[model samples]
Target chain A: MVDVNMTLEMVQASQVGMKAIGAGIAVGLTGIGAGVAEMAIGSAAVGATAENKDVFGLVLLLTVIPETIVIFGLVVGLLLLF
Target chain B: MLKPEQMSRLLIVASKDQMAPVVTELYRHNLFHIEDYVEAGAEGYEGFKIGSPLPGATEASGDLVKIRAIENAFSIRSEDFEVKQRRKQSGLQVLIEHELPAIEQEVEGLTVNRSKLETKLKEYEQKIAELTPFTGIPGDLDLYRGYSRLVVFAGYVEKEVSLSVPHEMFFSKGKGRHFTVVIAAVEQRSVVEGALQEAGYQAVPIPDESGVPQERISFYSSQITLIKKEIEDINQKLDAIKEKHADFLVACEEILKVQVDQTEAPLRFATTNETFVAEGWVPTNRVDAVSDSLTNVTGGKIFITVLPIDLEHDVVPVEYDNPSFAKPTQMLMDVYSRPKYAELDPTLILSIMFPLFFGLILGDVGYGLLLLGMCLVLRKYLKVDDGAQLLTVLRNASFSSILFGLLYSEFLGFELPWKPIMFSRHLKIGGGEAGGQGPAIPELMMLAIWIGILHITLGRILGMINHARQDHGDHRIKAVMANFGWLAVMWGLLIVIWTIAALPLMPDLTSLPKIFINLNAAAIVGAVLLVTGVILIARDSALEIVELPTIISHVLSYARIVAVGLSSVAIAMVVNFIAIGMLISPQLEHITVVGVLFIIMGVVVFLIGHALNMALGILGGGLHSIRLHYVEFFTKFYKGGGKKYSPFGYKRRFTED
Candidate 1:
C-alpha cells in the first residue's frame, strides 16, 4: 500500500512538472516567433523613419504589431500555470 | 471638438491700383490660406494669367537677403534671443535706411580684419612647423635656399647617406625621424639624388628666411601669437556690434520679410491688364470680419465673392479646432495623419486615452514622479518646437501614472503601507513565505479584456458614424451594417464565453433572468446573434470573412497591458532582491573589510540596475500605450490624409505694424 501511495504521489509531481514545461514552451516559442516577425518590420520602420521623422509614431506602432502574438502566448501560459 | 475648423472659399477681385492695399489688409488679418492660381487648366477664365510680383519686390527681397547674410555672419537665430518688446515698424524702417549701412560697414571691416588675421596666423603656424625640423641641422635658414652652384636636399631619411662626389652633409635625429641635409655641387646632383633614394629620403621644402633655424621658428611663433591677439580683438569688436544691433537687425529682418511677402502676393493671383483676382480659403466664422477689413482698406471698392464649398472636387485643408489643453495631442495625430476635413477628429479622445494607457503600463509612484520631474525640467530648458509639446503629453501621462500607482499600491515595485485598493500586482511565487498572496493576475487580465471590449465597441460606433456621414450611396449603408455586424459578433462571443467559462472576476450570467423555459436562453441568443452577424458581414464582402479571427485576436491583444506591466514589476523585484537582499543584507550581518566592500558593490548594482529598469519602463510603457491606440483603435475607423492649412502671413515676433 505504501508503494502504491508513493507511485500516486510521483504521478502528481510529474504532472506539475509537465505543466511547467508546457507553459515554458508556450511562451518561449511564441516569443521567438514574435522576434522573427519584428526583425523585418523593425528594419523597414527604421528606414522609413530615417526618411521622414513624422512617421516615427506610426512606424513604432508598426514595428511592435507582431508583439501581440507573444501576448497571446503569455495569456495561454498564464492559463496553464494558474 | 470632434471636427476641424470650417473653411469657406474666398474670391477677392480688385483693380491693380488697390492690389497693394488688399494684400496688406489680408496679411494683417492673418486668416487666409492662399491657393496659387494655375493658369494652364483654369476654365472660363482664359484671359486670366499668373500675375507678376509688385514693383518693389526685387528691392525688398534684396534687403531681406542682406539681413539674412548679416544674421548668418553673427550666427544669430531669433529663437536664441528674447524679444522684450516688439519694435515699431516705422523705427525699424528708419534704422534700415539710415543706420543699417553704417553698421554694415563697421561689421564688414571687423569681419575682414578677423579673417585676414586668421589667415596670417595659419601661414605663421605652417612656417613654424616647416622650420622646426630644419632646426635639427646646425645651419642658418637662408643657407638651405638661393644656392648659385650647389643643390641642397634636406628631409627625413630611414638611414644616413654617404655621398660619392663633393658634398657637405649634416645629419641629426629629430621628430621621430633621421633628418639630413646634403649640399653638393650642381654637377653631382644626379649621383646625390641616387644616394638619397637608396637611403629612403623624403623631401621637406626649405623655408626662405634669413635667421638661424631656431630663431626663425621663434620669430614665426611670435608673429602667430600677435596675429591671434589681433583676431581676438576684432572678434570682440564684432561681438560688441552684435550686442548693440541684434534687436534692430532682427526687427529689420521682420519688416523686410513682410514687405517682400506683400510685394510677392500678386504672384499667386490671376490677373489681366487692369485687375487681379485672388482665390483662397478663409475660416467660415471669420468671413465677415475679413470682408469688412478688406472693404474698409480699399474704400468699399473691393469685390468679394464667397464660393460654395465643393466636397466632391475640392481638397479642403484641415485646421484643428481643439482647446489649448488638447493642442499638444495634435502632434500625436500629426504623427499618424491629419484628419480629412470631412472626417472626425480624434485628438481629444486620444488625449484622454493615451495618458490612461501609459499610466496603466507604468504604474509606479517613484517612476511616475521621476518622469514628471524630468518632463518639467526639460520643457523649461529645451526650446525645440516639438519637444515642448511632447513633454506636455508626457507630463499628463506621468500624472496618470501617479494616480494608477496609488491604486496599485506600488512605489517602484515595492508594496506601500496601505493595502492595494484595486489589486496587488506583487507576485507571491518565491521567498518561501506561506499564504503569500499571488498577484491578482486573472483579475487584471479580465480588466484589460473588458477595456478592450469597450474600446473596440467605441471604435466600431465611430466607424458607423463616419461611414454614415459619407456619400457612398448603398456602400455607406453596407459599411455601417458591417460595423454593426462586428459589434454583434463580439458581444455574442462575450456572452458565449460568459456562459461556458467560469473565469475569475466575470459576472455570472446564468443568474440573470431567463427568456426561454429551462433551455439556456443565453446560449440560443448568443448563437442567433453570431450567425446573424456572420451573414451580414458576408453580404458586405466575402473577403471580410477571412478577417473573422481578428475580432478574437484584437480582444486578446489588450492582454499586453497586464503582461508588460507584470514583466516590469518582475524586473524591479529581481533587481531589489539581488542588490539589497542577496548582496547588501547578507554582507551587513557582520562588519569587515570584505563586507564593507560587498555592501558598496551592492549599492552600485542597486543604483545601476534601478536606473536601467526605469529607462526600460518609460520606453516600453510609452511605446506600448501609443501602439494600442494606433494599431487597434485607429485601424478601425481612421482614414487620415488631409491637407494642412497654412495661412499666408508670418507671425511677427520682432516687429509690429
Candidate 2:
C-alpha cells in the first residue's frame, strides 16, 4: 500500500533530519577532540615554559589552531539551523 | 630479516671516581690544561680541566708534540708532576712581543676605513634629505596614520578647491573640499607664511607658538636615495678589503692555533696524576681494549668493571627532570636511538600500518595517490636523515592503498566505468554484482586476523627464547608452555570445529571425513599435552594464580589489530556515503550554481572528513602498535634502557664539519 513516488521525498526528508543530527554530533565531538589535542600542546607548552617564560603567546596561538575544528563544526551547525 | 638486539651490558661507567682517571688521561693526550685544588678543611682534593681540544689541533704534528710531552712528563716519572702553570704567563708574553703590534695595526686600519666611510655616508644622507620634498607623493596614503597638517601653497589665485578623497570615504559630507585652518606652533609659522604668500593667499602671516602642520614621513623621502648610495660605497670598500686580506686572516688564525696548542700541550701532561685512577664510558665493543689500556698505564692498579644499564625506561633525575613530560620524551628518545627495537628495525610496521589506516579512513584513491606522490617527492628531494627509511615504508603503504582503492571501487569516492580490479564480495559495490565475483570480505578479515595471530605468536616465541637464554632450565618452562602449549591447544580446537562444520556441509567429500576424524583425535591428545606443558611452566612460579591471569591477558591483547582494522573500514564507509550522496543528489540543478555548490560541498566534505578520520586512525593505530611491541613483543626478548656511549668531542649542530 506504499506510494512509490512519495518514497523519494520521505527518504530526502529523513536524510535532512539525519544530517542535522550528524552536524550536532560533529560539533559536540569536536570540542572533545579539541580538548584531546590541547592535552599534547599543553604538555609541550609546559615543557617550553621550562626554557622560556615569554612563549605564552606562541603556545596560546598554536593551541588555538586545533580549536578551529570546533569552530568549523559550529559553522556547519549554524548553517543547518538556518 | 634478522632484528637487531641491544647488547646485554653497557660498557659506560657512571661512578665519579671511575670517571676521573679516564678524563684526566684523555685531557693529557689532547694537551688540555688541568687545575687541581683543595678546600682548607676538606679531607679530599678536587681536580678539574678544560679537556676538549681546540679547533684545528688534531693535526699530526700537534698530536705528536702532545704525545711526546705526555711520555716525557707523566710516563717516565711516577712522582707528582704538577703542571708549570707559568706557561700561560709565558705565552701571553710571547703574544705581546711577536703578534700584538701587527694585530693593533690591522685593527687601526679597519677603524680608519670605517670612520671614513661613515663620514661620506653622512654627507650623502644630508643631500638626499634636502631633495626629498621634490619627489611626487609616494604610494597610498592609507598606510600612514596620525595627525596630518597640510601647508598648501597656491600661486597667484585664491579659489574654492576640491581634493580627491579615498573612495571608501565618499559617503561623508564636505570631505572632498580643501579647507583652510589657522596654525599655532611658532616653529612652523614662517614656513606656512612663506607658502601662503607664494600661493597669493590673503597676505597675513600669523605669528604663533604652534608649528605649521605637515605630513609625518616627509623627511624620509630626501634621505632615501643618498642613504642608499652611501651604503653601496661602504659595501664596495669592505668587499675590496675582504678580498685583499683573506689570506692574511687565514695565516693569523693558523699562528694562533699553533700557539694555543704549544702552550696547552705541556700543561696537560704536567697536570695529570702520576698514578692515574679514572673511569669513563667506552663502546661495549671497546671495553676490553679500554681495560687493557688502563692496566698498562697504571700497572694493573686500576680496577675496571662494567655494568648493564637500561637507556629506555631508566629516568636520570638530572636538572631537566619533569615527570609529566618525561614519559613522551623517553618515548621520543627511544624513537631516536635504536628505533628498530620498538617494533621492527626501522619501525617499518608502524610506518606501514599508520598510513594504510590513514588512507583507509580517508577512502579516496585520488587523495591517497596525491598524498603518496607528495610524500615521495619530499622523500626524494629533502635531505632528511630518516627520509630514505620513511620513504620505503610509505611507498609500500601507498601500493597497499592503491590495492585497497581497487577493492573499495572508489576514486575520490566516485564509481568507475571500468570493472574494478578488486571489489568487496560482502557488500555489492553499486548494487551491480550479486554473488561472489570479487575477493571475499570474510577472507580479507580472516587474513587480518591471521596476521594478528602471527605477530602475537612471534612475541610469545621471542619471550620464551629470551627466558630460556636468561635462565637456563626450569625458569624458561613457563614461557615455553605459555607460547607453544597454548598454540597447540588452539590449533587442535580449531581443527575439531572445522571438522564438525564440514561434516554437514560436504558429506560426499572423503577428505572432510578423514580431516574430521584426525582432528578430533588430535584435540584429545592436544589437551593432555597442554596440561603437561602448563604444569611444567607453573612449577617455578611461587604463585600459580598470578601467572595464569598474566598469560591469558597477554594472549587476548592480540584482538586489538582486528578492532583497529574494523574501525578503519567503518569510518571509511561513512565518509564514502556522505561524498557520493552529495554528488548524486537529483534536487541540485544540473550545470547551475546549485549544482556547483553541491560538487564543492561534496569535495570539501570528502577532504575534511577523511583527513580527520586519518588523523584519528593514526593515533589509535600507532598507540596500539606500540602497546603490542612493549607489552607483548619486548616482554619476551628485550631488556632496554642501556646507556649510550658518548665520547669527548665537539657537538655539531648543522653539519659534521
Best by lDDT: 1
- Tell me how candidate 1 scores on lDDT: 0.86
> What number of clashing residue pairs does each candidate have, in the order they appear?
0, 22
Q: Write the per-residue lDDT of candidate 2 for residues A1-82, one digit (tens) a residue.
A: 3457778889788778888898788778977998899889988987886787545434544554455466455545544643
Provide the DockQ value for model 2: 0.06
Give a tens-digit lDDT track for model 1, residues A1-82: 2355568778888888889999899999999999999999999999999998768767776787788788778888989887
Best by DockQ: 1
Candidate 1 regions with alpha-carbon error over 4 angstroms: A1-33, A52-61, B146-150, B159-168, B174-177, B184-199, B428-436, B507-541, B544-546, B578-609
lDDT of 2 by residue, B1-657 (tens): 223333223222222333344543443333111222222332322453323332344553453443333333223221222222223334444544455455445545654665776776675555444333322223232322233553322112243423232111111112332223332244465655654455344422222112221232344344555556665765565556445433333333334434454334333321233332222334445557656665565555565676555444432211111233122223322442332232223233434444454334334465458557866787756554455545544555556566666656655445445554543422333343221243344444444434545655665566565555545455456656655654544444444444445432222222333334354444455456656545554554435434454443444344444445445545654666666554635435557777777778877877787777665654565455545555554544445433333233322121111
The per-residue C-alpha lDDT of model 2 at residue A72 equals 52
> What residue runs in model 2 are displaced by over 4 Å at the alpha carbon?
A1-82, B1-272, B275-368, B377-396, B403-441, B472-483, B489-519, B542-563, B584-590, B620-627, B636-639, B650-657
TM-score of each: 0.89, 0.44
Task: Give DockQ for candidates 1 onward, in order.
Answer: 0.50, 0.06
